[model samples]
Target: MFDLEQYLDMFLDESKEHLENLNRNLLKLEEDHSIETVNEIFRIAHTLKGMSSTMGFEKIATLTHKMENVLDDIRAGKLKITTAIIDLLFEGLDILDEFVKNIEAEGKESDRSIDNIINNLCNLNDVETTDSEKDSSSQLQDDFQYVTSIAQKAKDQGINCYEINVKLEESCILKAARAFLVFKAVEQNGEIIYSNPSTEDIEDENFSDNFNIIALTKLKKEDFKEKILAISEIKDVTIKDFDKDSINLDQVKNLTVNTGNKIQQNNEQNIESKNDQSESKQRKGKTSKTVRVDIDRLDNLMNLVSELIIVKTRLEDIDTDLKGQNMNEAIEYLERITTSLHDAVTKVRMVPIERVFNRFPRMVRDLSKELNKEINLIMEGEETEVDRTVIDEIGDPLIHLLRNSIDHGIETPEVRKSLGKSEVGTTKLIAYPDGNNVVIEVCDDGSGLNIEKIKKKALEKNIITKEQAEIMDDKEAAKLIFAPGFSTADKISDISGRGVGLDVVKTKIEALGGTVEIESEKNKGSKFIIRLPLTLAIIQALLVTVEDEKYAIPLNNIKEITSISTDNIRIVEGKEIVLYRGKTLPLINLGNVLDVERKSENNSKEIIVVIVKKGDKDLGLIVDNLIGQQEIVIKSLGKYLSGLSFIAGATILGNGSVALIIDTNSLFQREWYS
Candidate 1:
């Protein structure tokens, strides 16, 4: 016996893919209601309905069935596309999304009723009543199986047998088309064992709107009725439990047929031959080229590669002692293999950022309608790929930033017109690779950040003093929006201004080992620039030592290394500063910050300083020794040592020793620097 649950995961995965396709195509249709878009939407919806019915998700199957009908009507030029209709479709999509979520969690359809949405969809096509009135008073014939052996096999396979009686609307003109649609709908849930008036007679409109179908399906009686009734112009659907045991094989075989049987049989054979040839051509035309791997499997592979690099480093250390040519060669070979393995793993984990960007256009559309603001979102470089881990964590922060732009950055059409700006505001999200970092910028052309308003809010919240506000430059004032619980909006609304400010976005982006910066000009617009590393698993780092402890600094942050005399250091406003390139730079003592004791009590004549850049600010880190540069694999310090502010992560060195990776961004937050 075949169990439907065995294929549940595959069904869910394919269903999700179809849902995503539906969302994308619907958005396209909303933009331009072309016939091509409508046809595509209808196809996706049809596929989803079939899959849902097969999986026993009656609500989803019914909802999609109704949607398919509406789309079919639109394609046939029976209905005009309108904003209200599009919104209703979007609402239907939202419910389907929820259904998928429920299926993911509980391994079955959600218990929530979608009757209201179904009614709306049906009403769009003037379908007054969607629910079928069960007329159990009239039952189906028990000995009516066309093929007794197939019916027995279907029963053995756990497929429930059903006989459906469908009635079409009185005003339905294309009777043949509606009957064909009915057959397709029934076939999606199960195989049709027999149809009254014969399949050919029904297709030829040999009967009225009423048709009877004996189907071998896994769907329950009520579920099957719902699936059929969901179709537009489907006046009423009646279903009865078909009993295979009660079917008499001898009686079914003895049933007589006339000359019509010869013609029907000949037609079916020709149709089957054509279908086989089409299927053969399709199979030969396409190639299976890709496979979906679990992300966890890739993460495990990355971990194994990291361990191998560590072992390879240890081997090199041992080879150095032997100094044998063969040993050196073997170690070098191992090094090459490990390097190649690392690169392969990194590429495997790389995913395009478009996965995160694809969900925004629809969001922006909804926001525009809600805010009464005409805004156009232009996205560029969506194909830029980054680490999957980075992609996963970056979505929410980007969503928050985009929402902030929609709510605060972009002005209303009326306001834009008043300012002599174009009535439609433009928001742009651009991404590109800059060295080892992927930079994403979200910009808007509207009334830019109001520095004075932000200052006033900060001052009222006591986030900054009045004196600070008076002396703050435009850039500095713009940063105040990131303060916790700060908002310039006069009244709180659902869109924003409920006390949670841009601080959340800042916190999340930084948590992903990235940084966010603000750039704004009054009445010109604002840009939020986010810089993130390509991958966090492996990186080239500059190793330095402070006393006996070794530390690694990201080479990307290091601008230059120089030896400066202690006497060159100067004190300005009670802060240690250095004059480099005719500019004063703050100097940080790495040893003191790490609380490491000095190796030599005797004062060294020259101090080695590393100039590092964080955004527009530069700081020179004072360390005891420079250990050159090396590629290292980052490892977490576990929960016990998790909160160390200055340490980003730990990495295994070439000699099997551990080195702490420095968090350069945190350096600026230290009290010594502030």
Candidate 2:
């Protein structure tokens, strides 16, 4: 029996890659109707068809086969590339994706969308202005596979064509290992001319227990089978002698080169094919390019480097004490090495913002159509780099902010015309480095924000008292729009305002030690500026002590820790309000929050208040004492301890004790009652 798992994974992977490339090429075909893009699109569809059929995903294979034919029409110049055709192609991709996801989730194909896309594809392909042209097209389709007329001269000269099928047991632990054993057995018999699953997948263990192979074996079929089954964990095997055209046809090359010889062989073969040569040239032509990496690896690497950075900072601190002494030379040398290491390691973790930006184009286009508005989205500062940990959490928040901008910020076409603004709305997404953080701004030129509507909504929710709403600062009220389940829409649209409010976006960003601030005008548009740290793996934190307990507050949130006179701490509204910078700041006694003892009888000049701000809201964190600031590696509280209310994450300091990093937003909420 065949091992189905490898084949299924191969099916899923090839389908996804094909879908991505199909989308990219479809986008390319729109701008430039070059023969290259059409051919590229055709190749992707062809691969998808083959993989789907082999995996027994008949619906996917059938639909993609029709899609491939239509693309062939484009490539052969029978059909011109148009937006309608592009839309059809995207529709096909979406259907295929939906089916692939169904297989992933439900372990079976989804037929709901397959028939609809296939019929549309058939109609699109079958269209003709006249009967003669349709006949001419049908004749060409019959002759489409002509490229198989390959290497007759080389083959008839005693080079026999062979097709080999190898199947492993379903209970096999390593299907790829079995595949490799089969590969070795085949090479011992003759050269493997072609493989159905592709060569890279064989090496990558990207195949099922049962894979088909076509080789030009010098030995007879029985000889090949005997050698393969002799291996341990061997199941069953079959070898067939194939026809002539299949012999010299270049099989799909999907092998990851392991040795220098394999790379050299591929390079030589690449030199022979103009298409291969051109793709290499095109890749080299790109000034800036993108690479896909698994986020988990980046996370782990960032963590290890962050700890090193923390230790380096500690070494620097140690050097500070020895600065003017006999150890100055060694200290200077240490400083140089540490500084260089910091720069290099930090660069390793700094990925460009383009990783997040590339996902927006399709989103904006679909959203504009959904709203029946003409909206253009423009992005800038794609080269801005942030720490990898920060990049992972930034995507959803940015998307939510963009969605909010479209739903609430931009006015309808008629409203914009009535407001004397351009009928088409334009939004700008800007990201750039600011101080030690990256600021992402989503600014729209829609009808700004309806402040009066927001005030009324706030009053209804009882989030604010009517008197507070009457005196609420416009800037403060602007931030309220991000509150939980809040929306100013009179009637909910299909896109947003289904009670999945911007509060989730705010909460997510804040959880990453970032801040989301709202800025808006009444009619011009609104700008949601999200400031995120360059890297969350490590941060400059204020190490403070309340009683005997130690904690870290992000240095970004602290303006300064002002030592207040006990006289300045006056009671207001039955709460201890400290006067700082000429304003009353609600005080948070860290000793109380941590439930620790406060040993202080003399309050004359002993206490410290760290002023922290989130958006426009500020709070004074009163700790029993301020332990000196230090750079610390932030670690999560694992899965079980994540919901620890006021704690953001825990970090291990140099002396091996752990300190809980203060949650900036949570502390802000804590101050609401303090």
Candidate 3:
């Protein structure tokens, strides 16, 4: 028996891709009423209909079929594209999306009522609803005519057309698989142009034990029957010649009269098919290739690369004299190979950020209407790529930022015009690769962050003291918006204003080994910049020692390294601080924070400090000694030890010892610094 479970993942993946295409193209259609866009949408709808039907998702199939009819009418110029029509189509797309989500979550479509959207679509196209049996019977005459046309074409090409009937045994378990096998067998002899219950119905096992096929082949009747009966489950096979002359002349005339446009469409399709064949032949040697491997498999491949790096490190630590010059050369070569392998695996795990950016245009459009504001959203650098793991976690943070921009940053049309700005406020989302990081900036040309308002809210929420707010500069005031439980809005709504948005964005981004910063002016605009590492698995880190405990600090976060004398360190507000490069820098002692036991008191006068920058703030971490830098693989501290104060993860050292990596962002939190 065939295992349906094996195909579920593939089906869901493809269905989601199709849905995304439909949504993207529909948005395009709304803006530009071009025939190409309409036809593309029609094609997508038809394909989704067939796929859902074959998968036995009757609601999706039925709904898409209705959508297809409306698109067909629009293509035929029977109905004009309008806002109402577009909205109705969008409503239908939403339903289809929900259905797909339900299938993915529950292994079946949702039981929600689709009658409203279905009826709305029917009313739009003036299509009458009918029972399945009635619908199938009504299409029999059209199906017969279609088969006759194919048969006539085959006869002209000097090929014989035959109607073949095959019946399966009553005990047939996987009817769909058996039918597919039969089709494959028949295709080897000739082409099966038509089927009795339609190919989709047969694949869905919606038919009885018996089914018919119209085949165009050069083989004789007995030979075709013999080939089909060779299958294991076949109970009987019958074959008969299909004669076009047997079709009634009156019926042909009526079909031509009623479906003249459809016939023209069929002719156009034939030309397209011939063109496609020519193109296929011209490009036969080259094939586009892609494969969808489960994420777990990619993670395993990354683990292997990490192990190879560890082995390389081990070889490098070996005594060179005992192993000789050959060992040195071998180690060098292994290091080069491991580096290249690591890069290759990392590339494999990287995906274009466009997957996360595609959904925002629709979101911005809906929000524009909801807020009764004329807003234009511009996006760039969609081709920037990040690790697959980052891609999966980055969407929500970006959404929060975008929503925050729309609700709190961009002003209304009248307000914008009064401020001498464009009536239609503009919001821009731009992404680009910067060195080892991908930087995403969300900017708006509307009213910027209200510094005073933010400070007021911070004080009201007890997020900051009045003394701190009074001394805060404009930049520091803007940063206050990211404080937990901070909001400047007078009332809360669905968009934001529950004091839960920016903090979440900040937390999530920092958790992904990224950083978020804000730049804003009172009447100008606001730009939120987010910087994320390309990959999380392996990174170059500066190894350090606090007392006897070893730790790793990500190289990307390090701005500079310097030493300060004990006399230069000062205390302010009961926290240690130092003047560096004419600016005050807060200092955190790593040994004290981690509670590492001191081996002995040091008589050293200088202290080694690693300066790490989070956003616009800088802090110095006091460490015992620097072990230089090394490429390290980050391994998660298991669930039991997760959320360990400032430890991000652990890495295996060359000596097989483990060193915990510092979470620099966490150390920069207000509690640690302020």
Candidate 4:
């Protein structure tokens, strides 16, 4: 028997991708009402319906069929697209997305109330309720004529025609697998001539607790029943010999006409067959070829490459000691190969940020309707690639950020008109590569951040001291929005003003070794700039020793390395500071901050300072030694060391010792508290 569970993961992945395409195409159809877009949607809907039916998901199959009818009518010029239809289609897509999620979690689509939507779809498209719902008798009627003819021919050849009805237990978990076993059992004793819901539908689990099959077999009826009963989870099985004499051709033709199965209609079949062939070719031409790989497999491959690099690094250390030319050359070759392999693995783990961006258009549309505002969302550089790990964690934070923009940043139409700006507010999400990082900027052309209001809220919430609030500049006050429980809204709604979102965004971003900053103009707008590393698995880092222990600082955060005399360091109000290139930079002693015991303090004549940039500002990190830069793979410190302050992760060095990766941004956070 075929194991349907083995293919469940593949089905869920493909269905999600197809559902995403449907949403994208439907959004396009709503915007342009183009024939080409409608055709693409029809093709996708048809494929989805076929897949769902084969998988035995009746709800998904029925709903997509209804949607297919409407698309069919629209493409045929029998109906026109309207706001109601667009809303209905979007509603269907949302339910479908939810259904897929449920399937992923529970291995079956959870029961959801879809009758109202299905009814609306049927009423809009002029399809009978029963026809769209796939009543078993009506569904069986579509194949009655064909089955009768085949059964008559079998009867003439001295073959017994049997109708097998299988009722599985209600608690059966793997219904599809069980149904496949039934088919296997039937085919072993006889040939399956026809089935009520079709073999594809049975395999897909489109039916409820029971399915029917008609077979021509030479075995005794008792023997066939015993074969099916041996399978597990079967509630009961009923076998009856089908009598061809009782099947009236006229009645079969009438039932066929009543059932609106397009394939049964004589002239429509030819036309539909031609259309199917044409669409098959079109789909073949337009389909984007891709495959899904298991993430665990990729992670295993990355670990292997990391091990190879560690071995190479060990060999390099030996080469320096032994001074063998041949060994040095071999090590050089190994280095080149490992570098290429690292690049290849990183590329494989890269995915376009568009995957996260695609869902926002639909969200913005719904929010605009709910808030009674006109807002246009513009996106740019959506094709920028980021590490898969980053892509997965960044989505919720970005969603919270966007929701904050719509709720707090954008003003209403009347307010915008009064302010001499366009009535429609604009929110733009743009991403691009900068140095070794990816920068995402979310900006809104609406009422900008109110610095005084934010400061007041910050003070009221006890997030900032009154003295600090009084001395803060506009930029400093705006940053207070990220402080815990800081919201300027007078009232809380479902959308925002809960005082919970931005803090989570800040924490999550910082956890990923990224930083976020806010810039605002009084009447113009506000922009939230988020900077994230390109990849998290492996990085170019500058290794430094604090006291006796070593740490790795990501090279992307370092601006420059400078040597300053101990006399050059200035003490201002008991805080260590240094003036570098016309800017006063605060200095943080790595040894003291991480609680490492120092051999001595400020005893050396020369001090090594590593300048790290956070946004437009710089901080000098005082270190004892500057180890050379190297490419290292980051490894999580696991749960025991998870909450270690200012430490991002740990990596293995050539000496087989673990060096904790420092999160430079967290150092700034520590100083803010101090």
After best superposition, candidate 3 residue 423: deviation in angstroms? Answer: 2.6
Predicted structure with the largest lDDT when compared to the true one: 3
What count of clashes does model 2 give? 2
Q: State TM-scores per candidate.
A: 0.76, 0.73, 0.83, 0.76
Error of 1 at 343 (Å): 2.0
Least lDDT summed over 10 consecutive residues: which range in candidate 3? 251-260
Tens-digit per-residue lDDT, 373-404, candidate 2 = 88888999999999877776788888887887
Q: Give the alpha carbon lDDT tens digit for every residue of 561-601 in model 1.
A: 99988888888776788888998889989888888886566
Over 4 Å off, model 2: 1-21, 27-36, 50-59, 100-113, 128-134, 137-294, 306-346, 497-500, 599-602, 671-674
lDDT of 1 at 326: 86
lDDT of 4 by residue, 1-674 (tens): 66678778888988988988998998898899987788788778877886877677888888888897787667544577889888999999998899889999998988998899999997877643334345645544545755676566666766677978899999998888898899889865556755656544565577788877777676788999999999999999999989656555343422211112221231233222457557756777776565679999999999999999988877877746676888888989999999999999999999999999998998898898999988899999999999999999998888888887888888889999999999999999999999888999989987788888888888888888999988888887777788777778798888885234888998898888799988888779888899998888888999999877999999988999998888888888788887778878888888888899866765888899999988777888889899889988899989998998888899999889889998888777764323
Q: Candidate 3, residues 1-674: lDDT per residue as tens digits?
A: 65677788888898888888888998999899877788888879988887887778899999998898788667645578889888888888889999999999999999998888888888766643233235554555565666677668667766778877899999998888788889888876666665666565675588899887777677788888888888889999988888656445343322211122433343334322557546755676454457788999999999999999988887877776678888888988999999999999999999999999988988898888899988888999999999999999999988988888887788888888888888898889999999999999999986788777788888888888999988989988878778776788788788975235778888899999999888887778889899999999999999999877899999999999999998998988889999999999999888988889888876689999999998778999999999989999999999999978989999998889999999998887646596
Ranking by TM-score: 3, 4, 1, 2
Q: Which pairs in model 2 have colliding backbones?
A: 200-254, 200-255
Give the number of the best model, judged by TM-score: 3
lDDT at residue 335 of model 1 (Cα atoms): 90
Judging by lDDT, tell me the better candidate of 1 and 3: 3
Per-residue error (Å), model 4, residue 474:
0.9
Task: Report backbone clashes per prediction.
Answer: 0, 2, 0, 5
